[model samples]
Target: MFFRFLFAVPVIALFCLPASAGQYDAQFRQFLKSDVAPAARQAGVSQATLDRELKGLTPDTSLPGLVGPGGKGKPPKINFQAEFKSPARYFRDSQFNALVPRGRSLMKQHASALSRIEAKYGVPRRIILAIWARESGYGSAKIPYDAIRVLATQAFMGQRPEFFKGELIAGLKILQNGDVSRTGMKSSWGGAMGQPQFLPSSFLKYAVDFDGDGKRNIWSSDVDTMASIAHYLSAHGWVKGRDWGYEVFLPENVSCTREGPDNRQAISAFVREGVRRVSGKPFPANEVNQPGNILLPAGRYGPAFIATENFYVIKDYNESDAYALFVGHLADRYGSNKGFAGKWKPMKETTRGAVRNLQQRLEGLGHDVGGADGLIGFKTRRSIGRDQEKNGFFATCWVG
Candidate 1:
């Protein structure tokens, strides 16, 4: 179910196989009493809360990405031979077509609440709506797991147990605070709880009660859900008036290898280099002096952009350039509903293993492939473009 949540973003964990409960039930319960209980106590969770929440709890081995009871090994890899994708396919027009109309209607229905959120957080209504639309289909997507159960199981055996341990404690604290009932505190398998899909830690830090019902019911209240999303983005530094990014035409002489956040310069610097908005409009005067970077997700093979810090702010929500782009572009669609002006030229679909191999090879050649993690991040794409330029081939800045 958590894997299903990423349909609108990076598919981070691809564990499709159901987990089966093994022989560790007794030891897992021991772990909760000795390891988790003290932490929850220190975090101000009551004994009653712990007694009620942990009773009858057993490890849900059917959940994906868990290790053995000792939690010493890496979680098993997603079964290999699953299809890998090109970044181009991530921007399919059909995905946008299905979502835009639904999002527009939600905007009108939640218009008043959205206005208050923007005024409070300085994040615009459309951006907030886009995040809500993506996270849980404007609160319609069914979240299928109990948050405490999911967090406890992951803390017991899932990958990154220490991180989940902290989140597990936070979930206990959420229960102690009376925000939601045991049944209502639902989550995706990864423990991103409720409509905004916040991890328990995030829920504790940023989830807000906008409707003033004396409880923050992000699970069913549209107002709380919208406010929470805006709060997360604003806390991560969403710029008030700036758009996330703009599609632009990068002139031939301007190097594609300049694409990344580390290489940011004033937008005017790009204008001087002949990068123009595809709309032929001048760069906004306020934007010209601010920092931006060249963004070519599929290199020269697809749309180009001059992305602002706000774009990176979206990435803070989920650390993928593609994820942020989907949110930003989808937000734009609720207004005029147009697709990218640049086309995604067809390319071979390659696996993460292949991409990691290419990254390793690039590293051997004295290039920074951004640690060879098997994702074609901006660094990897630019490194590929640099290599292509050295070979006297036109740099597509992509895996051709």
Candidate 2:
């Protein structure tokens, strides 16, 4: 299971309107009236609702897209030295530290809401708070694009129409409910909205008015936002009191692999396969019996983690291993652990191109590293590390 912060267009670009603003706005308005309205009507949205939501809306041409002017070129191929050496590659310690106080404050402020959610849903308040802090910086950050325009653009662009179309309808429903003004319904370019950064469909399904003011106002309502996050996690199988899994030390000569949940042997089977507990802290036998899959996100240079059901539950919020690890680690920190026992090996900067090359090279050698997408995800990183060990390149197999 992958988990990480939901992807966002860089916050800096959020306010930068596109150069073709007028033309795109005109085109978008026409598209909405001609296409989106019809689609919404077909989806059971009332004409009155559609009229209120779609009228006066304009396209945000500033949103990032593949091959667009603002799009960066594909990231460089993986090279162990460059990624580690680059100052920008790793998470900034200072930034993370700064976020802690704010995170703690929000945790306290929303303590009651969190406690109530935990009692109802069986997910920890700290974990929910961690997600809240990470997603929108405790509700201070603004989502800069109009939800409808972004969804319409993504749907019309045809990359993920089936998914975005559903999101669009849900967004219209949000507007129809009068919970937010159409003008105030700004969202991430990918269509995630408000503090918990939910896509419209997710908001519709999980958002709640915890304060009971009769609106699920995720944008400005702290109670509603935090509760919505808890609800989402609960719906996704978050088990209260169960650790999301711990860091482990691999024994020598172990056949360590990053397998997906479906392909993984039972936790008992893997325990018998010689996986050993590395945390030094003892766990209950039942907890050990819970199935997990290993993930080496930053190749072998970074720490490895065994993801549990709760990890996948976090992934239901976002689908990146880096993201899941961050949330899990943050949760661990907020709950009282500093970090993993093993230290990440130092390496150079890893560019998108290098990551793609690493995947291509690994796949060519008969290891399925998923596609040669520039993202150096767990599968690709693990395959590379294993291959590196086999080839005597380096046991750590740090990537750049």
Candidate 3:
């Protein structure tokens, strides 16, 4: 549900509808009067608020990934020809280096408040800081769009119109509550509001008034922003006193096919099977008996990790392995600025269509690659490895 606003790696070039030129203004008003106002009223928004806010509102056709009035055109295309970078480039040391110092400074600056947040929420401050940096560059990124306008536009014209319609209603409710003025409620073009990049529904559920300002002002309050992120993670099952994951050395005999959260075993089981921390240290005593699963983000081409359940909790914030790994690794870097122990080998450039083709082949042979979404999630990675094993080759868990 969370979409990273400022720190996304552009894998697909999005297409926007041409500028509205007021072409859909009449339809948009009809939609508000007929479809939205009733729902907003059900959700406790007043008729006066609707009249004052939505009057003369035109759909913002210039937002990215638009697909006409009802997703009528071919849904936005994945730029199948876009460049695909290897994990080495994606997790370059320089990227972390650029973010670490500021993160460290912020960590110290907010030490007392962070201690209280951890005490109350059981999420580490570093994790909250890392997510903050990733979501909006620790509140440095500009969020310029009006949240209601963006949500209303998406509900009227963008892909997943019904979903955005719900968010639009939530945005109106936020306004009706007077949490923020409509003019001050800024958001990304995608309608992820404020520094933590929460959607309107998420803001309603998780935003808090941490600075005692009597309003959950995520737009300008760092305390509110950090606390809100911690609250979201905690609500999604952030395990107390546990870390996300650790980089590890996987022996050659350890098949990469043994990947994914579904294949979880005790951390000690992986250790007994010859996994070792890349730091040459033992797993924490508390963690040794806890469940973890192998995470091979780049199969055998990049770093290996034994990810704790807490790792998946981070994934709930953004459902991407790379995004979770980036947050986890950056959180770790707030204290120790080390890079990965296992190097990411260079990969041949491939496209989403190529990956989809490979997934289809694996699926035909009775492997589930998580719906052939053209992304190399754990299911796809392990499916590749399993196919290699079936062909009597070493399973690198990577695309050949």
**Best candidate, lDDT:** 3
lDDT of 1 by residue, 212-283 (tens): 999999999989988999989999898898989999999999989999999999999899999999888898
TM-score each candidate. 0.94, 0.81, 0.96
Show model 3 residue runs off by greater than 4 Å.
Answer: 1-10
Better of 1 and 3 by lDDT: 3
What lDDT does each candidate get?
0.84, 0.67, 0.87
Encode model 2's per-residue lDDT on 1-400: one tens digit a residue: 1122222101122233335546656655666777777878998799998877667766555555422211332322223333324222334445566667777777787777778888988888778877887788887886888788787766544346556667888888888787788777778777888888888888888999889899889888988888898889988888776767667665544444444564454566556656656656545576776677765554455555566778878877777655666677777776554645666555565555666787888888998777887665556656766787788765443463
RMSD of each: 2.4, 4.8, 1.7
Taking all chains together, the TM-score of candidate 1 against the true structure is 0.94
Ranking by TM-score: 3, 1, 2
Give per-residue CA lDDT, model 3, range 123-146, as digits (tens): 999999999998889999999998
RMSD of candidate 3 to the truth, in angstroms, is 1.7
**How many steric clashes between backbone atoms does each model show?**
2, 29, 0
